[model samples]
Target: MAISGPSPFLRYGVRIANEAHTSLDEAAETLGLLGYAVVDSGLDADQLEALRARFNAIHAANHASTDVERLRAIGEVDLLRCPLADDPLFLALASNPRILELCERLMGAGFILNQQNGIVNPAGAKTYSQSAYHRDLPYQHFVSTRPLAINALFCLDPFTLDNGATFVIPASHKQEAFPSDPVIAAQAKQIAAPAGSFLVLDCMVYHCGGTNRSAADRRAVNHVYTIAMMRQQIDLPAYLGDDFSTDPKIRQLLGFNHPTARSVEEFISQRKAK
Candidate 1:
């Protein structure tokens, strides 16, 4: 028996490339099947400039202090953890409605922001923590029927082959363990996206940041949104203080309503009150 395209005996269906679908539909579908998708953020020039400026300023401040040596010791460099605590713009970007829509589709209602960090692939750097391939929920070797978390990484600079675009293994989220080196070498794909675009991913996807071979740094802001039951990377509600936002959605997204109880009585009371 000759196989013309895919074998009819195969149990799985193959998606046709270049199908006619709306942008949101394409993003949702790709995120499910490929473990990642790229979507235009639609930020204007001024907005893009503002985000880039903020990231640069924060990056400089972090690098100027003892934090640089401390981070470098742990193989982490050029990272600004929880930049939203420093600027309102970062908070706004974290809660962008378009991003929330996709998060809602994958994570269902009431997903909370797990972490937001500013990432920089320094020009001509040999290695950094992010350069190593790992899952957003690192050290886990399990697959979920649905996504437990998703990363919405906003590009502040255009991602290119010369400037360290992200490398991802498509549909790797479905596997229980990291693929062998040969499989990774054969299947890893570099994602190129313009500034003011997002490279969204299933948190389980195996991916890494590429080394920047270009003359300039590549900057991005990464937001991880997870199901509300998961602990946040940072205690955002506590870190941001009680008065971060009056909007109910923003409050909930920041984990304000999901605080831990101090005692059994408090836990029962809190549940009853809810």
Candidate 2:
């Protein structure tokens, strides 16, 4: 008799159910095993509506100035560093207690906010920028027992198979080797969550956005969180400077006042004190 591997489909379903029921610890365990987790109805109705509206307004304003040729080629627009950055609602959503707890489970405390970008995938786009299966972080030869980074994709609109829902290769994060095209194609699973759902993923997972073939734009925002020891994709502290809120959680998420020695002398002093 031989032992068999877990079924990706069944495993993911169980994980999603776990997250939906607020069994965060179980969901985190599943995420560690499968590389992804889906939390249904993570946001309230009013919160979802507000996020959608704010995203729409900002997208329309910025897209008006975008080069048509670039838009045509890309078929998508990512509003990098969302204008609603200052909005406590967006900040709260990004660092939602549940999400933070899940992240902390894998990455430990002092997770830094790495990115927040609103994505709009228009229908019938000739070339979807993120259609290729790839990892979020730059390729490295090594892997970590603990996750270095994680993502939270908040769905502002229905994520349908035909509307650019994300595709992921289950358990790919555990593999130290880069996935070949054939491997990715064979194992990829397209995920469709309802509006207001939150999809969390390990950053090392092989994943991609599906092509949009629907009539309307598929909207979502991505919030990336990483271990505080990792370098931020964007210099958030520099950008925000003194303008950001004084909220402790917000400050922590933004990587402000993270415990660190500024120099060798400081490190020596702190060590002596300890």
Candidate 3:
């Protein structure tokens, strides 16, 4: 007997149809296999422009604020936390139908937006907090049959090699602890994508921002979606207040319905209300 082609044992692993067409299909297949995927964001020129403008305004405002300066002192530079609170545009991006669909596929229904952050890798910075490899669900050390959380990072600028595209360790989400330094160097992959693309990752995957050797800054908005049981990075409902969105789906995504009860009476009231 002669085995001329690839090993049949390859069939033992996760397999999808060769004809898997559509961005969602590709994203699902790759996320299942490599712990990450990139798909077009489908934002037209005008939308992109508006998002960029709003992001810049927020960045300027935050940069001068005392809170942001405090954060910068600790090496967390150009990181905009909860941008959705400042502008509705970020919320719209976070609730993109395709992104939500992908999150539903991986995390099942009732997933909530754990965090939304606008990150900038400044030009010629020595290092930033995100330069260190860490999971979105930091400090956790366990693998799940399915993803507990996922990150959809919308690239606002071309993610070129010189501009500091994100670096990811392929299939690292399956491991409980970070691999050794040598293993990381061998397996690390830099993800270079266009401006209107979303880099989706399993939150368990170890990843970090690359250095921006270019003269321009690299900008992105990151949204982390997790199962409803997990606490949000910020109490989004409280932060955004009641006027943010009237749509139930949008409200739920912002964790309006998942707030913790402060007392036994409140718990009973919530259950009754439900």
Relative to the unseen true structure, what is the Cα RMSD of model 1? 5.2
TM-score per candidate, chains pooled: 0.91, 0.81, 0.91
> After aligning candidate 1 to the native by TM-score, how far in Å is the CA of 175 from where it should be?
0.9
lDDT of 1: 0.89
**How many clashes (backbone atoms < 3 Å, residues ≥3 apart in a chain or on different chains) does model 1 have?**
0
**Clash pairs detected, candidate 2:** none
In candidate 3, which residue pairs get closer than 3 Å at backbone N, Cα or C atoms, i.e. clash? none
The segments of candidate 3 whose C-alpha lies over 4 angstroms from its true place after superposition are 1-19
Candidate 1's error at 176, in angstroms?
Answer: 0.3
lDDT of 2 by residue, 1-274 (tens): 1123543444433434323333676568778888888866467788889877877777777678788568656654554354435456676677777888888878888788888877777687744667777788867645779789898888889889989899999988887888787987798899898898788898888888888998888888888899888777667777777558688778888877554677999888868875
Q: After superposition, how far is residue 273 of candidate 3 from its true place, in Å?
A: 2.1
Query: Candidate 1 at 78: error in angstroms?
Result: 1.0
Of 1 and 2, the candidate ranking higher by lDDT: 1
lDDT of 1 by residue, 1-274 (tens): 1224544454447565434246766798889999999988878999999998988888788788756677888766777899989999998999888899989988899999999988889899877668999999999999999999999999999999988899999999999999999999899999999999999999999999998998898899999999999999989988888987898989999999898888999999999999
How far residue 90's Cα lies from its native spot in candidate 2, in Å, is 1.8
**Superior candidate under lDDT, 2 versus 3:** 3
